[model samples]
Target chain A: MEITIAHLYPELLNLYGDKGNIATLKWRMEQRGINVTVKEYALEDEIDFDGTDILFIGGGSEKAVRMAANRLCEIKKKFEAYADNDGVVLAVCEGFHLIGTYYKLNGEKIKCAGIIDIFAEYTPDRLIGDVLLQSSAIGSTVVGFENHCGRVEIGCYKPLGKVLYGYGNTDSAQYEGVVHQNIVGTHLHGPLLPKNPKLADYIISRALKKKYGSVTLSEIDDTLELQAHKYMADRYKNCVRKKNDDDI
Target chain B: MTKIRNSLAIVACKLLILAGRLMGKKGSSAPGSIAMKISPGVLRSLASQIKGDIIAVCGTNGKTTTNNMIDSLFSSAGKTVICNNYGANMLPGVACAFISRASITGKLNADCAALECDEASLRHIVKHVTPTKIVVTNLFRDQMDRYGEIESTAALLNEAFEKVPEAMLILNADDPLCAQFGKGRNAVYYGVSEDTGLHGEEAKDGRFCPKCGGELEYEYHHYSQLGKYKCIGCGFERPNPNYSATRVDISDGLKFVLSYKGSQHKLELNYRGFYNIYNIIASFAVYETAGGTIEEAKKVFDDYKPQLGRMETYKVGGKNVILNLAKNPAGFNQAIETVCADKKAKDILIVINDKPSDSTDISWMWDVEFEKLKSANLGRLVVSGLRKYDLGLRFKLCGFEGVVIEDISREALEGIISGNGEVCYILANYTALFETQKILKTMEDK
Candidate 1:
């Protein structure tokens, strides 16, 4: 199988080791003998997104996000077309925030790709720490870290998962992420995929299923991967239990 | 009223420090934490009583080493100086340092103080004590969860120096972020004067012009964004450093000639890693600017030994065992470069913790060039700590097999020293560093 993944703003949005997602994709596919072409599209770089099988966008600081938003405005139409064609994408943190209708910055609305109906607003209270999610799409717990200053709000769409622990969309919301067609957007970036091999495979399968009309993902030994995911998840769970017990 | 409050705060801080020591806890910051609570003016009043210059060292990396080196220069001159211990560089710790050293009469007898202040906390510290010289080592993306970005941290440091305009600023000209601070200020810049042909670090945080936000063109990088740089759009270029290290030879131990004041002085040091040269040069710049002569600095550099895991070496099983702290991506990259230089197979143990001191965010491990260590012939890979699985997964992604896992520091140390290798290298983060170091110390003692 062959997959072509296009990364947007690889330089500006290269915060929190988000590039690990692309590396994890390439690593997982190469293990299955799947050929993957990774192309980076930085600012002022022009390329048609029609043929791109999967799109990966990472998070960044507020300054980087604004720079990306300015450059991405020129390519909004091209991105909308890609989203319209049910292109597979995995966006995290501010990248996911930019996938929405608009993201608020210091009360000013900075328009994003406008592919999805979701939007995000900057919050004074940052949602940070280990996050545990019961993701319905994957039928398993998705564990990662969230260190974002903004809270996302999915407008009339099915979210990616429920917040089992830690702050999700907002401090009180149960939803952790939102899914739009083949695109998955979340704030989980403990690089998001290295520890969660299942999600890595899910994104890879989504890309293959979109391009080849069928998915054939060979299983690899995920013993260590699950161990890593459970390690953080269990720690988070115990802390939550401790907090609840203290309240009593 | 203020005098009584200050005296009470110091006496209370001293009693707590004694109590903390008796309880088997080195509570370095707790008394400072309590002192700040009792009297907010405790730091300000005590620092005012200092008889000499106070130099505040600010940077993402090398602050501890640089500040300690300055401490060495002061002691070499037989002068009393105050300093916060390693890992206690925050505002509370700065208060504790002054509180512990102050007379019960609320007066400080120290002649000088070289404080390693956290970049984010420098603004707060300056509001208390106006440093005579502000030493900015270099800025890089460290503990992003704390400051959000390097620019934000730089802005905090900028605000810090603005509060004390009379202070002579010591800046790193090689770093664009540090160099940018020199603009419209009383500042002296220090940088390396050669292109070592080495792409020092993989991650470049200072690739853009701080003034114009344009792409920066580098003539040569000493490592990770530290180099000779010129803005492509705006004509902002690297300023001529007041203190420059010419002919830096790091093939073996560090050798460099300091060029400043229209004269050159040669100095050599027994140290590993390219960044140590910057740390020492920064310390020398402060020590000299504070009134120490070149002869004094040269003497201090001759046999200067950095403690608390600045490539601290121990002999174990008749083989060399080196320990160092790798706190951030850039720091880990430099530490890895030093480790990869050895040709013989070595046991490499990496311990990672997610404490607040350790940044709690281990995502930056992906930025460290662990892949370079893959080319390094290794006898064993031992991973341990609170976030051992995260570190293990990172090394696993680098395509290494049979990673020995040990969560306990003692077991991890034993696993490495007992392995089939000619040497052992233990690299850990802030919280895990001393634990592994103490364990290795006991093992060596036995």
Candidate 2:
């Protein structure tokens, strides 16, 4: 089975290298011998969410999110079905809000996919800079930057992961993302997947199991991939962690 | 006492710039993290406390040009329009404008204050002053590092406009994102007419309309998404413009006949390219909306020459070289189209730099249609800059061969500039623009 990545709004939701996440998923899946087809869906092209395997949305300003709100509403039912069926999905920053519970974009309630129970409120102050995300599932930390004015509060559903670095909910470093079944959403933009390959490998591994019953990376490139991960993990060990007062 | 403190601040800021320039440091006008620390509301309140009209011009591109044009046009109209002409359109520049123009008694002397601001800064700027007028030139994909998506930018502008309902807005009818601000607000839309030759086929690449999730159809594209588009699903389309360009002729730079208020005014401009034509049309709309007669705008527009670097023509090494700004794909294409229309064999110099502010995320370069250059009757293309290899790779992918990829060494750059070419075109991004200018300046100096 092939995973189809939808048309990413590179101009609007690309505050960071958010598209890197899409590229990472594609490369990782291909490395495991899983076929992946990526298509470009521009503003003029028609979108059929039924054919899409996974949807990737990036971050943008609240205005940009609202501007895209009407379009998202057009594909709302199909997007929710994609998430409900345990289909693999990833949305970051503004993309996260598009698929989340509700987005308080521009001081108005815009309907999102509501796949995850998180309410995003736009704050005058933006949480801009690097962040450290500690995952209870992986028992490790991932580093990325968050440049957003919207604050997402973890409500009803289980938190995706706890924020171990920069601010998540405007003032407090709490939850960083929402993970329910196979649908994963977060605010870790930048070259997030490349910077943290474990997350990339994990998503690919899970997707492969569902597709082919079992998956395997070639033994020939095993050492190289392992070394790359160790190097990246070491590089981000302390860079994005919640800083102590003395660390300043 | 307040005036004394503000004066001290302005003088100190100016000194800092001088010192940074003297030391040859890159950040001469770098607004430190401290500037961001101050809230936009506090800043606006401070500026409003000072007497005068506050006007802001914003968009993905043309903010600098339109803001500068507004300053020039208003100044030519004999109005004291104090603006930061050096592209310091952030909070600090607004602060500096207020500090510099205010009297010793703390009262402002200007008839109006106009500033060009970045798209991201619009939200912050709105907190400070309810501008008398706001002009959005056009919105295009620019500086992806700062703004993620075009829709986000539209949302930010919409929010900013919510606070400034009293301010009259001038928008681009061709740009759906910018034109959306016209909804339920006192807004005047200015855009190029559908009469301009429309491209038969839309670009296979670029952003989609946020409303329909379908390919946004443009009646006539003026580079990128700055076109008349109507979404098939929602019927969301270009808004009716208050001031429209009846006939846009781009033989040299951008010249157009603006139809507004029952009279057509011929706007002849030295600034070449479709981008500048849009800018000129927007400026005319703003001027007409501000109660200026078409005759008054015509007199001012005719005298308006090219700014420092928008499209300054110069004689370099006995060859005519036009220096144009091409920061993004749309801007670059507009610049290329302007030169290609000349019908003369022209030598092109394209520079791309992936600096921090220039955005190391260089994926957008892939979206630029380099194949358009096939129609450009050109002698040779001298490609040089930090990302020379990337540009060379892109050209190679686009099937561009024999294009000279030279390192941006002084001797090599000068050699390319002074080479055997009838016409030279220099296209530079943010990092390389000033350096290219400095090189040109040194050549003219000799």
Candidate 3:
């Protein structure tokens, strides 16, 4: 089945090489010999979302996010329906905020998709720095950077991960990201999939399972990708230990 | 009583800054932060009460150097000047300088104040200072995480300048993006002549005009977006610069003849690269417009040196390491060009951290001309940082063979320095530069 990646505002949401998320998925899926046709839909584009399997959105500034909200509100129902039927969805950073229940910016409340229980509010201080995440579902500690002024509430429902370094939820151990079934939302950015290859393959495997049911070769690809991620993780762990020991 | 009180306040401010520095909060605006905490409206009131001219220097690159040069020029001309030479360009930093210099009654000490303002902080500070002059060096896509785009920033600057009442605007004529801001204002333009053979091609995407959305025509690019350009639709050509570097010969560090007001004199700069030449011309123009004597300008230009870790040379682990800041693709590409121009094989260590300040988005690496790194004399490339392996992948994609990756930034510097003695070029972003410098300093003590 073809993957339809609906990038909310590829131009605006792509401040942090966030477009690399979609590019990484396309290349890796093609590597697994899947017949993948990716369609990129942006704001105000008249396109049917009926056949879209996977949707992708990334990050942007507060002003850009509000501007995108006003535009995406036009097609909010279409996006909610796509995710409600278990269609794969990946929203990151500002897009993650845009897909939430409500986003408060500049003392104004803006409506979002509201499919998830996540609520985001802008703060005086900007959460801008490197972030490490420990996720139970992915079974690995992932690292990336977070640059935003808004604080997100994961609603005590479920979190994709918890922050290891930078601020995320602030209430409980810096909880990070949101994952509900086939839908995954997080702040892990840029070549986001390259750093989390297992997560990429996992999303692909789930989509395949939902569509084709119990594929063997896809599982094999998932294992290989997991090994690659584990190798990098081990190297990172070794480096951290050496650094802490002042060996450098 | 007033003198004693002013001196006490200054001492307190200095002590706070010193403590902040010792606590590893370098560039932390301690004085301003403290003053604001103590008395909020004092800084704005003091700035409004100042007698001398207020010049705000701002841009992505060269703001520190340009501010330093202009400050030095003003001081050399027998005028007391106050400036933040430590690259603290935020609101609090700007306030810190003014606060420390102010009298007990909140009156300023210096005859003039030249501040290096960050582009993002321009709107907030401009609301207070009401500057007499504004100098724009150049515009490039730096700090995507903070400032959105070239146009978004330019719009903010345009709005800020609207508040100032008839200020002398010093602009870089070569930069089409910055030059557009000089429109409908009392402006003076300064740019490098295409005489320097070092004038190379710009990054293709960053060269467009911020206004009109039309393809910008360029006579020649000094580096990145700073070049002679004109819009096709509106005939916005490079304005006949009030001050221009007529004969720029950059073969041996930057040396150029600056001509203004029917007089031409040879100007020598200690800094290298085409970018530095633009910086020199900008300083000369602003100084001359602000009533600087020729002798004072020469003395300041000759005496000034590069800031810390920006083309700063040092000895580390029995080898010579040149530490330079290369935050963006344009800057990194130019710095690599400067290193390659030395015509000697050099060992290099490059740190690429995807920190929020260093741009978590590393896609701009694809735009950098890694092909220019194929100089014959370059020996080893030790890539390290948070995204060291990713950078190594990019280098390999650019056909770099035998790249060693050490994901940890601390070891990467030591690993590269531990190698055989060779001329080394160390390139790092904002945070990594400090770490690299600290590591090299520690190595020296041993």
Candidate 4:
């Protein structure tokens, strides 16, 4: 099977090694004896979302998000059509925020693609450091880092996971990220894939199934990858548990 | 009254240092912290007592190495130099450095003070030091949690520049972000004119012109965002550098011709990589503009050993173990390029940490072009640190199939050294560098 990955705004929205997700996804598919081709869509390049199998978008600075939002607005219809057709999409960090209805920063509303039913606003303080989430969608504990001032509010969608550590969508919300069908948006970027090999495979299997029907992926040895994931998950879990104990 | 405060601060700092020594602590920042607490204006008072000019080097990277280079070059020219060579660049650490150099009477007995100032702390430090010359190395996105963004970090330096209007700015002409600082100032620009042709597939930061917000068109990229660029919309281009590296031959160990004041001097640097070339040129620019000869700078370059962990080398089990600091994408990419350029089969160890000192966000590792290393003759790939598995997964994703280890300790180093590769290149982040160095030191002692 052939997997066509469209890396959206790779130049502008590329921050904090978000490109690693693309590398992980491509490598995972290639390991399964599947042919993979990556197409980069920047500010100047025209994108045909219909031709893409899996669409990946990474995080970026505020300025880069603004620049990318301006370009993404032009192709809003194409993106909506791609999503409506059940195209696999994974957006992270600021890219995750841009997929929502709109993101409000510094009292100014920046209109996004409005593909996902979510609204995000800049919080008074940025939520940073390691994050651990018991993701229900992937049926595993997700480990990554969250560094953003925007607090997301999900509407008409389920969260990708429940926050085990670190702030999730909001300070009070127990959930993290937004998931609808094959589309997933999260603020987890340890580039969001390397340590979480199961999630990487989940996204790949979903993409493959969407194109070629129900398929069971052969298990690749995830011994080292799972060890890395458990290490981070346990560290954050213990850290938060200690903080709570001290609070009491 | 101010003299008495200065003396009291000096005595307190000396006592703190003595106490730290007795306690077996390398109280590198404590003395400065205590001295600043004893006297709020101690740094200013001590700096004012210096009989010579004060030069401050500030940037995201290369501040320590470049500051040390300026210190060594000035000292080689028969000038008494006082510097913070202990890799403490913040306000308190800088204050500690100044306090240690001052006499018991709080009088500075140095010909010049070459201090490395942190980018965020530059505004605070420049207000007191009032340096005669300020050199800014190329700015890249680093420690985003502390600095917010690259623009915010640049704003900090810009505010500092306003406080010290008399200071001559030594700017990097090739870096568009650094080039922005030279506007409406007495600036001497230094950059590479010849291309080294080491462009990577990684995304470039600061791609837009600060003046018109127009997308920059690069003639050729030497590395991440450091290249010959022009803005077609506003006609903004690289400034005519007063001190320019006219020719670069990085085939061996960085041989470049530096042109200044209608004279070109060909000097070969002992350091490797394009970033170090910029560091060497920036140091040379500061030294030359400060009334030092090219001949004297050449003597300093010939014997210039990179400060520990910037790109320090050690021999272990008769194998070359090269250690370089890879804190951010730009630095890591340069290190990977340097390693790939060598044809010999090598064992590579990448140590990544998420300590507060190392920038808790390990997301920048994704930005590094690790896929390029897949083609190299890498015998073994070892990944270790607080985020060893993250790096191991990154390498695995890059299609590097080798014995990947996660143990980041002396045992890990020993295992890698025991491998068949004749050379071992260990690239580590900020905190991991010290740990790896300590482990290497213990192994050497054995």
Which candidate leads in TM-score? 1
Off by over 4 Å in 1: A241-248
User: What does DockQ give for each predicted structure?
Assistant: 0.43, 0.08, 0.12, 0.49
lDDT of 1 at B271: 86
Candidate 1 overall lDDT versus native: 0.84
Cα lDDT tens digits, model 1, A16-61, are 7877788889889999999989999877888658769889888887
* Best model number under DockQ: 4
Query: What are the per-model C-alpha RMSD values against the true structure?
Result: 2.6, 7.3, 7.3, 3.0
* Interface RMSD, candidates in the order listed: 5.0, 8.3, 7.5, 4.8
Q: How much DockQ does model 3 earn?
A: 0.12
Candidate 1 chain B, run of 10 with poorest lDDT? B196-205
lDDT of each: 0.84, 0.66, 0.71, 0.83
Q: What is candidate 4's lDDT per residue for B1-446, written digit by digit as tens?
A: 87788789899998888898899866578788778887888888888877777999988778898999999998888888879888778787788888877887878878889999888888878766879999999888787756666777888889999998999999989889999888899899988887666777564778877666678899877777778899988988888788888678766888888888999888877777878878888998998887888898888888988888876788888778889998988888888988888778888899988887788888888778888888668888888888877787777776667757677877789989888887889999998998899889877633
Query: Which candidate do you rate higher for DockQ, 3 or 4?
Result: 4
Which pairs clash (backbone N, Cα, C closer than 3 Å) in model 3?
A: B174-B227, B345-B377
Rank order (by TM-score, best first): 1, 4, 3, 2
Q: Please list the residue runs of candidate 2 whose C-alpha ends up more than 4 Å from where it truly belongs after superposition.
A: A1-248, B1-4, B7-52, B103-107, B198-217
lDDT of 2 by residue, B196-253 (tens): 7734222222335555554566666766666778877677788877788867777764
Better model by TM-score, 3 or 4?
Answer: 4
